[model samples]
Target: MIRTALWALGWALLLGGLLAATALLVLRQVTVLHTWHEYLIAAASFIPMLWVPLLLAALGLVLRLRGRWRLLAATLTLAVTAVTAWPMLPAPERSDSPQLAAEGSLTVLSSNVEYGGADVDVLTRLAGPEVDAIAIQEMTPDFEAFLAEAGLFERFPHRVGTAREDAGGSMLLSRTPLELIDRTEGTAFDNLLATTTLDGTLWHLAVVHTAPPQVGAEAWTADAAAVGAMVAPYTHGNLLLVGDFNAIAQHHTMRQLTADGSLRSLAAYGRGRGEGLWEPTWPVGHRIPPFARIDHALAGREVSGPRPVYETVPGTDHRALMVTVSPSA
Candidate 1:
């Protein structure tokens, strides 16, 4: 009797875990945030890699357990993980076109320093001579002072945008001259629109820091829409947008913004891309590996594109994203 009960319990545990994993993945793909429960679980959208551990366990259990049940479990988990990850796969065929004039290139690094607490030294190192522009969120006077003290300004002297004591501040530091076109306060932060000449082409950039879902789902939706609208007008041009979105590309709000086909996500190098290899970039230095990729770069159609580099800084909860954008030649 006791032995039979133990056997039943093991089966229950295995099946239950598989069910939970499927539910998390499916829910993120389908559910629109309506109720409190739906909104809370929306976080599942950020950590799709949750399937990795489940796949490993299933593979291990197949070797340990006898029977067809083990194979069934393994198969199901693999299929689900594959389907969920399918969108991230690369389709480089999509970026090429003759409309966007081949002119010049610009390299930019965008970062969120976790309330301005990231290591100034590491940031300075990452902000090297090759980068043409730097867009930063959660900027503080102290952080600004540190960057200036580090001699970063001498390398990229043109500075435009805002700075705040709180998480609301944002700024664009550029090697070339920057003309501030407009600025908007995001749901809980700052957004700036500026123009700079990159290799003689008039390039426009919108630096944004959206409200995280922690602020509430509705607010996040509003912020995402605002970002989408901000970029929608330029479907094909020299427009580059970058920032810490606190939301993944697959989320409902995120999809809505990118859906119109103007600005394409530059982070989609799923398998064999450059340094941008599709990966998560948040909650860094937390010991647990990052499972959410809320930081991203989106560019206009003619932008011949971004070779992204994701680098980790010691003190921040987020990794710095460096993208080099060039016109198609």
Candidate 2:
């Protein structure tokens, strides 16, 4: 009876692994799985450690199967592993061209201050000298006060957006003069639109913060799509959309934003110093490493040479995403 049970358990594991693999493939191809299926896939992409279950199932089959069946089971396991691992692969090397250097460059820093949870001193220290503009999310009154006390305004004289107690607050600070075009503070998403001149060339910048998906499925989907639509107009020109997106690259919402091929993620641009295609950038407080990269700096096709660098903010749950953008020939 014990031997029979072990064999049955092994078969169950194999069957389950195969089914999960099929589901993942289907999720990738279809867009209608907008509720739990979408959320689960997005969460799995965020915490890839979740793949351990499938791995364990594959191992069980490898141990239980015999002869040719054993070989077939091992192959199936390998396929599952490969498909699951594809999204986490290292990014390709970016081309270094003289033209990219010849064009005017803009350095922008996108950070989530975690509603005064970050160390103000660290932000002040990092923002000066290197950053041309700073896009911040979760800007509370306490955080604004800290920025004032730390003399961040001395470097970034021009500012926009409102400070709120909720996670919806957002602000954009720049050393150069900025012209405010539009601002939105809605229940779904918060955005600030402004334009700044870089070497006499005008470029649009959108500071965005989407509501967390955990709030509700409909809210999450609407928020992501709203932000995408808000920035769609600027894609034809030199634009930089930066903020705590609250969604990963694999999420269907994220895919919808980049579907038009106008806006492209800095990490996914395939030209950066980072090894992996995605850099984890949230939940940085408690000495625990971040598992998902929710913060992003996306550039339009006209923009080039955007190399993203991530830094941990002293007291916040998110790391700052810094990147330099330049014009493309």
Candidate 3:
């Protein structure tokens, strides 16, 4: 009876591991799994770490099995693991072309300050001479006050957007002069739209903070779609949309935002450290490594050499994404 029970348990473990791996593989490819795909994709970011224990369990089960069962388990487990792990592989080396130079570049930093909870010191440190502009979500009244007290306004003289008490607030600060554009049509969210010329090129900057999907599924979808539509008309020229999107790259809404192929993420450009793709930037306060790239800096083809650097902001749950972009000749 003991031997029979052990055999049954082994089979169950192997089958379960195979199924889980297959499901993740499918989820990585398909974006329309359901309305809950956002949450699932967010969870999928951790699959690289999750697969180790899964592989071990499957290998142990295979060792316990015999003959055809062992062979089948081994084949399925290996195949499934490879499929699920492919997306997380280190990115390839990028070319060292001179077109990617930062001589005529505009450096922008986008961060969610967690409603004034982020450390003022870290925030001030990142808003230095290298950064041409700074876009911040959750820019509450107190956060504005902190910036003012810390003399950040003097550093970045030109500013736009409103400071609210809620997470809907957003602000854009630039060293160059800013011209505020009316972007309040067909939306209830607080997003800032402004244009500034950099190196003789007119660039439109949109600071966005979409509604969290966990709060209201339908609203989150609508808000994301609306933001995409709002920016569609300005796809040409040097355009940038940056902020805490509250959605990862794999989320369907994120794909839709860049569906036109004109606007691509800094991650997509693969111009930063490592593979330069899928760097996580959220939940920093939990004392764990970030596992999703929700904050983003997206631009059109006119923008090139996007280098994204994620930095820790003390007291906040998000890592700041600082991307530098130069005009493509």
- TM-scores, one per candidate: 0.82, 0.84, 0.83
The parts of candidate 2 lying over 4 Å away from their true place are 1-9, 35-54, 68-103, 269-276, 286-289
Model 3: lowest-lDDT 10 consecutive positions: 94-103
Name the lDDT of candidate 1: 0.73
Candidate 3 clashes: the total is: 1
Weakest ten-residue segment in model 2 by summed lDDT? 94-103
Better of 1 and 3 by lDDT: 3
Q: Write the per-residue lDDT of candidate 1 for residues 1-329, one digit (tens) a residue.
A: 88566566656656765666666666566746422443553556544655554564465455446568767867866885686555444323433232332357778889998778988888888887667899999999988998989998898899887778999888999989999877754467888878899767878888889887777777777777777766666647788888887777667766666677667788764424433344778879887877678898888877756446688887789989888787653
Alpha carbon lDDT of each predicted model: 0.73, 0.76, 0.75
lDDT of 3 by residue, 1-329 (tens): 89787877776666776677666666656766524645664555554445754675677577677899889869867975785455556445655333343555778888888887998888898876678899988889999999999999999999999888877788899999999884645444577778998777788889988877666556667778877877777877778888887777766678888887888887763455554545567778786767777888888768775557778888889889777777776
Local error of candidate 3 at 122, Å?
0.9
- Cα displacement (angstroms), candidate 3, residue 205, comes to 1.0
Candidate 3 Cα errors over 4 Å, as ranges: 1-9, 36-57, 60-64, 67-104, 184-189, 269-274, 287-289
- Tens digits of per-residue lDDT, candidate 2, 1-329, equal 88788788887776776566556656655644644644664644534443555766886798688899889979977986886666566545545432233445788888888876788888887785757899988899889988998889888999988788877778999988989887654555468889999778788999988877677767777777777777778888888888887777766777888888898887773463454465678777656666778888888989875558788788788889778888775
